[model samples]
Target: CVGGSNGGVKIEVVDQGIGIPQDDLPRIFEEFVQLEEADQRGTGLGLPISRRLAKLLGGTLEAESLPGVGSTFCLSLPAAHPTG
Candidate 1:
């Protein structure tokens, strides 16, 4: 889902896969950090890199999840302004 909010763009991505634990949410954005229970093998740089890129673009990336339900990721970018 994508829409406008607070004079900016709010994009949300939702997944039905295994949700992340509240305790691990903050660590997930760290470099080379992966959950022990994760099934896939990865270097764990994805979220960290993504967040850095979003920050460079003047945006923010965040997540919310429930133990058994799912997860939601939101990327919010500032609205574009026309240059004279």
Candidate 2:
């Protein structure tokens, strides 16, 4: 889902699966960081790389999760207005 904000737009990607632990949330975006319970096959570089790219484009990336519920990855970016 997507929504408008004061200075930007919020884009959310929500999932319905085993949620991430509270303790692991902080490092979820770090290089090679992955929870054992999650996909062990993953190299865990995706999130960190994505975050860096977002920042380079003048945006922010974040995640929120609830145990056994689900997780949501949010990306906020400034709105682009066309100019004549």
Judged by lDDT, which candidate is best? Answer: 1
lDDT of 2 by residue, 39-59 (tens): 447888999999998788778
> Which residues of candidate 1, in runs, are more than 4 Å off?
1-3, 37-39
Candidate 1's displacement at residue 74, Å, is 0.3
Q: Write the per-residue lDDT of candidate 1 for residues 1-84, one digit (tens) a residue.
A: 343566888888999988999999999999999788556789999999998988987889999998889999989888877799
Q: Global lDDT for candidate 1? A: 0.87
TM-scores of the models, in the order given = 0.82, 0.80
Question: What is candidate 2's CA lDDT for residue 10?
Answer: 80
